[model samples]
Target: MSDRGRVPGQDYGVKMIPYEDLLKHEPLREFPEIDERTPATLLFTSGTTGPPKGGYHTHRGLVLHTLSTALAVKNPPVNASQDDVAMVLVPMYHVHAWGWPWSTMLNGHRKIVYPGRFDWGHILRVIHEEGVTFSAGVPTILYNLLMHPDSPKYDLSRLKFIVGGAALPEGLLKATQARGMTVISGYGLTETAPVLTIAYLRPEHRDLPAERRNEIYLRTGINIPLVQLRVVDEQDRDVPRDGKTIGEIVVRSPWLFREYIGDPEKTRNAWRNGWFHTGDAAVWYPDGYVKIADRLKDVIKSGGEWIPSLRLEDLISTHPGVNLVAVVGVPHEKWGERPVAIIVPKPGYEGRLTENDIKNHLMQFVEKGEIPKWWIPDKVIFVKELPLTSTGKIDKKVLRDQYKDALPK
Candidate 1:
């Protein structure tokens, strides 16, 4: 170890060896024969919904997931090839960085660049300097990249982004497309080796109108190869594919976790009815794509009707003055829970972004029959920043707890 790399040995109760001294020892000749079904990794959830739960995966599961991910990227909208340079923006600890380390190597990608930390300006430089052509991360990462003041300094036309970890807001998707970068959406959970779906375009979709194509590109997407997915009602019956009826998403894939490590109760609840319950509310399209409405816990219950907060957040994000936004259900007397939006305004619009501005913005969409009138947020709170989880996703649980009483009776 270098002096700079050394830590206090006494505190850890272990002796530290310098790099030169460690190198003097002979390396092991024989390695253990590991089984494909052997326990591979134990990853924890991002804790966005609640307490983080452990997801235990196997070597076989991870390997199969890597192959599926490679296949998804190589197909349709992404068209990834060995000639394309790859950069994984997601942190390695987060769902094993969405399995890019294994997939990139398996696909024979020419070069792989790892941006050390997520400084937007620094990331922009890495993308431009290293000629990075492909990458994957959550929507928040993409938003930060585009919002940085120095982003225009780099030519990001060659970039391709695979957004996951959260729903891809339509406004953010359009902004990314405006930069000439191809942006696609994906959906998964930490328990499923995290790559269940990719919003790839089919051969027949080539000549579709731009508006319709954009709509499909931003959906949660169809099931990836070897994965069985369905949106089910409370009785575990499949939901109608009318695009208006919402149901819970359930899935079965070769790479899903076996259990929630040491928590059989949670494990049982997650694996109900012989399928892994995703607890995500979504609507299935006639074309077989799945569009997430909101998490089951995050849906706002107002006047005996459910309002998807993700829809509200997505529309609110389109507002020119809004930077980051989160919609949560707050306690209300007339309506059990009412929608409240917490917003981080753009640099020039601080203190100017008001409840009326957001309500008026959403009202336009409602009038266009794009969203329900009740889906509009009742209250809007301006803040400098929204709380983020350790994995860089919006910490809605914190927001819900902090502002549970924001609405009056």
Candidate 2:
């Protein structure tokens, strides 16, 4: 029997078994012949609402996902070279890391694994020592590196490209680009092998003003070839592409996983009518780019309308004085569910900000009616830092656990 042990700093444990012992005892004498429909790997959905469910992807599905990603990033348009060494900073268990490992290997690029928890000093050291040319990580990881005191100590000149996902903070993208790094914002989910679209810089945008180019890069780019993406309303009808119509993003892709393992009911609901339901609410730009507003479940319904918490959090995070922000719905008898802004102020800016300052800052949106007055946060709670998940996204589940009880009755 295999024994399990936990990796340092990891919440979960892994089975301990030597490769030699495995070969000796349980080695496959003859490879099992499996069809394209056979299950290859099981990916657990990000448990934002409930317990994580295992989503199964077939070998055929994964192969397509890997090749398509390679073609999208390494083709003539982008031309990501095989000489480039990729520094993967995300957790190995994450679909982004696991899926890209095969893609990078297939493309003949050198893979430099971090092999441990993310530490800014260690990541910088690895980047400098390994002469890493490409890096892929979530926005939070990039934010930490860009803001770290020792960030300037290392020579990051060899870095050529960076891909941000799993929550792309707009301010972080701007900061990365200002530092002369070529940053691209992408979007995907665990069910899609975590890669659906990347911010493909259009040829025309290259010559545009820096501010304009940056704005385009902040939105998710057009769908990769062979993927059909649409924003639909409650009745599954398509929403407009005028850049203001927000709807749930549903995707149909050759690379999408077949079903959730052992959960037929959820699988049925998630794959209703053969489309993988992302549960993420988004808007499609006139330029064909998509911007995710918030998770449908996370969208705060106040005064009979939806207030996208993700968009609000992104806007709040842009403030120079704010280090992190999480907007959550609290019990509000008046508006049904009112927003509460939980903020982590920048190092020197603590105790200098008041609720009115935040309110005044968000007043521009209120004036435009892009955000309703009732949707404005009812309270602002200052905190040291936002709790983050293993994947670097804000851990909203933890935030709810900590503050749900304190919400006004």
Candidate 2: residue 40 Cα off by (Å): 1.7
lDDT of 2: 0.73
Error of 2 at 278 (Å): 1.0
TM-score of 2: 0.87
Q: Write the per-residue lDDT of candidate 1 for residues 1-409, one digit (tens) a residue.
A: 2222333222322333465776878875995677677656667788788787875677788988998888888876789899889998888888889999999998898999998887899999999989999998988899899989999888888898989998888888888888998998999999888999899998878789988888888899989888999999999999999998999999999899877755789989999988999989999989889999999988888999999989888889899898888999999988888899999998899987788999999999999999888778888999989889888889999999999888876
Q: What is the C-alpha lDDT of each candidate?
A: 0.86, 0.73
Query: In angstroms, how far off is 16's CA in candidate 1?
Result: 24
**Residue 38 error for model 1, in Å?**
0.6
Model 1, clash count? Answer: 2
Pick the lDDT winner.
1
lDDT of 1 at 5: 39
What candidate 1 gets wrong by more than 4 Å, as runs, is 1-30
